[model samples]
Target chain A: MLTINDLARPGLEPVNLEISAGEIVAIMGPSGAGKSLLLRAISDLDPNTGMVMLGGRAREAMPAPTWRKEVGYLPAEPGWWAETVGEHFQNWPSQQDSLATLGMPGDCGDWPISRLSTGERQRLGLVRLLEGVPQVLLLDEPTSGLDADTVESTERLIRDYIGTQRCCLWVTHDDAQAGRMATRCLRIEAGRLAEPTS
Target chain B: MSYITLDYADLAIAASLVLISGGASLVLRLDIERRLLIATLRMVVQLVLVGLVLKALFANVSPLWTGLAVVVMLAVAGREILARQSRPLAGFWAYGLGVSTMAVASTLVTVFALTTQVAPDPWYHPQYALPLFGMVLGNTMTGISLGLDTLVTSLTRERAAVEAKLTLGATIHEAMRPNARQALRTGLMPTVNAMAATGVVALPGMMTGQILSGVEPVEAVKYQILVMFLIAGGTGLGAILAVLAATWRLSDPRHRLRLDRLAASRD
Candidate 1:
């Protein structure tokens, strides 16, 4: 289970959230509803006035590297920093597993990330972090770029992966995507969590 | 060497020119106007005062005074570089110490060990040591700034990526590898560019000064080569030292980038 309390933003109330083990908790909200901010807080990308506990221990208590490794975050847009695909994997083996799981052939290791189509980059980013095998996965708009067909493929892939892993918190804007991807759905208005009636 | 006198008229003109330009700059950039104005005022006053002091220092002919003067200049330049370049004054002393060591060791190696001996003449001679030391310190200051700027920018931007890597069991160096490489290349660029343009487009300051003072063009050219060598050496020493300095102070024992000490202003 992943538990986040008071995550993101000051002066606003502390956000409380939980995604049970082996369940997909889909988060839906309007623009700037702290959706992506949630992913960052879990990964310790930006400091938030709150606590993130993955598994049992408080994430803040352990070093951030340990927390991030245990809980992977895939931002909406992938490949923000590294220029090439090979560059992304700095002599690490998890890279090989991620590339393979994303239906990429072995030689994809040599491919430059810029050459990858949008779907490929997004898929690789998710799979790459998963190769690290974090117990909790934080995915933000994992399929925003692809067409309907690719979206289905990504959703199925994530569902299958979560069945094997502990949990995944998926963020999306589309109602249909949330229903398709999430076992339980939620919405945030302004900055407060609304009941996931849908 | 033929001596050129600095007349009172030269001093007065330089002062007036500095005041007009310097005062206008102060009025225009007011938010951090104090920094610019004080730095400009300090530069003008310090250069002229140092020039006069050097003249007296040379006349007095004391190695102790000359050595002490260089040490003072190195300390001041090191402090300014560490302070002016980046934030987190907490790490300033560590950085200052590292840069100062390179500046002194490199200057001594160039003046005493490398130069052809005119022993007594070389000791307090503003002609030989001051200019060489100035070049090394100036480049070291710039190098450290560029290096620090690159590292800090990368640290903030790639904080997530770095954390990701570290969790993957990469050690601190492995985690910081990409950022470190980026900063190292950016820091090394100025010296590389100077090397590329050394002879063709640019007439370097020291060589130009020598040629203006009636030294033969070929003779000036020889000194230019030596000076260029010294500059490259200084760059290597400063860049290596800066990376080492930043590595220790930039992170906590937990190996996390500490933003508490980093200045709010990106520049």
Candidate 2:
């Protein structure tokens, strides 16, 4: 679970929200609406004037790696760290399920990274994040390159992962993905964050 | 060879180019003025000094001066490599050792063990030793600098991916192996490519210089080949050492990445 306050960027006013464990909060906005900015702010990759509280302690007061281990952040484009996919899962315990949930075949892990499609790498990247088992997951355009089938499967994987482990803040523009994955939804309009309930 | 006498006309010609370029640079707009002036001034000052000192050393013909010059050149090259990395003094040890060892080992073997004669006066001639050593050391220094900067910057940029691995129990090496390999490959590519394309595609500057100095083409080719190998050996050693040197602190005893130990970038 995480609480955010005064999380604003240049030429933008502060906005706030809270997310709970096992909850999927989909953030939707038009292009340039700072949807990805919200996730990056939580991840400590981008500095801003605000506080991010994971569990109860303020992220500002916690060590970055400690907070980061508790909160896994994946960029839209995942960076491949090695030459093979099996190498990606060799240390991961949730490897089989994460891969299967993302609609990846068991032997998909054996392919050389250079031979992989972007969508495949993205799916593997999601598995890598899940392997960390952080208390909070921040994803930005995570399934951008995935096919409709893979996207559906990836959304399912994300939902399943949140059901099993932690809070999730997913950023996407697709109305279908929002409906399928989000327990609650927030839309960023004119650079401000809001929950539909509020 | 004996002392090289200065022809005032040749001096005038070199000086004229520098001055004309420097003066032309003064009237130029922002971006290139300082660079032109600096490049011109550096060339003029460096060549003039090297010429004067080399002439004296050749006339006096002392082994001590020659060796001292070689040491000074190595120190300069070493300092340049460290400056580019710009980390604290603590981080430069392995780089210093790496560059020095590569430079000394390659030069000694090339000059003393193989060449048999540099100047007919003395086989261990300083004029040849100092300049050749400087050239090899400088290039390898650049190789280490490029490799180190790329590795450190990319490692920090991809910290999240690395941390994901670490939390999955990937050791520092395993986490960084990807970035480390990329940087190493990029660093070594220039040296490897140059060696591969030598002679037909491009004539190396050392070989060209030897030819201009009236050395036989066959002899020049042999020396060029030797120098290329020396560069490969030194650069390979320096690049690998620079990576291991900077990343020694990637992990703490707790087995987590000690991100804060990257004092250069953390600031």
The CA lDDT at A107 in model 2 is 72
**Runs in model 2 with CA error above 4 Å?**
A7-15, A47-49, A60-63, A91-94, A146-153, A189-191, A195-198, B1-49, B56-136, B145-177, B181-267
- Evaluate model 1: give its TM-score: 0.67
Q: List the candidate 1 regions with Cα displacement exceeding 4 Å.
A: A5-13, A48-51, A58-63, A80-110, A189-198, B1-50, B59-129, B150-172, B189-233, B244-267
Check candidate 2 and list the clashing pairs: none
TM-score of chain A of each: 0.86, 0.87
TM-score quality measure for candidate 2: 0.57
- What's the DockQ of model 1? 0.17
Q: DockQ for each candidate? A: 0.17, 0.10
Model 2: per-residue lDDT, tens digit, B1-267? 223556889788877776676667576643576787778779879988988988988777677887787767767776676667644324545355545554654465446523653444466566666666666676677777777767767777787677656544455577778788888887788898888888879898988877877788899899888777767776787677666666665554334555555545425
| C-alpha RMSD in Å of predicted model 2 compared with the true structure | 9.2
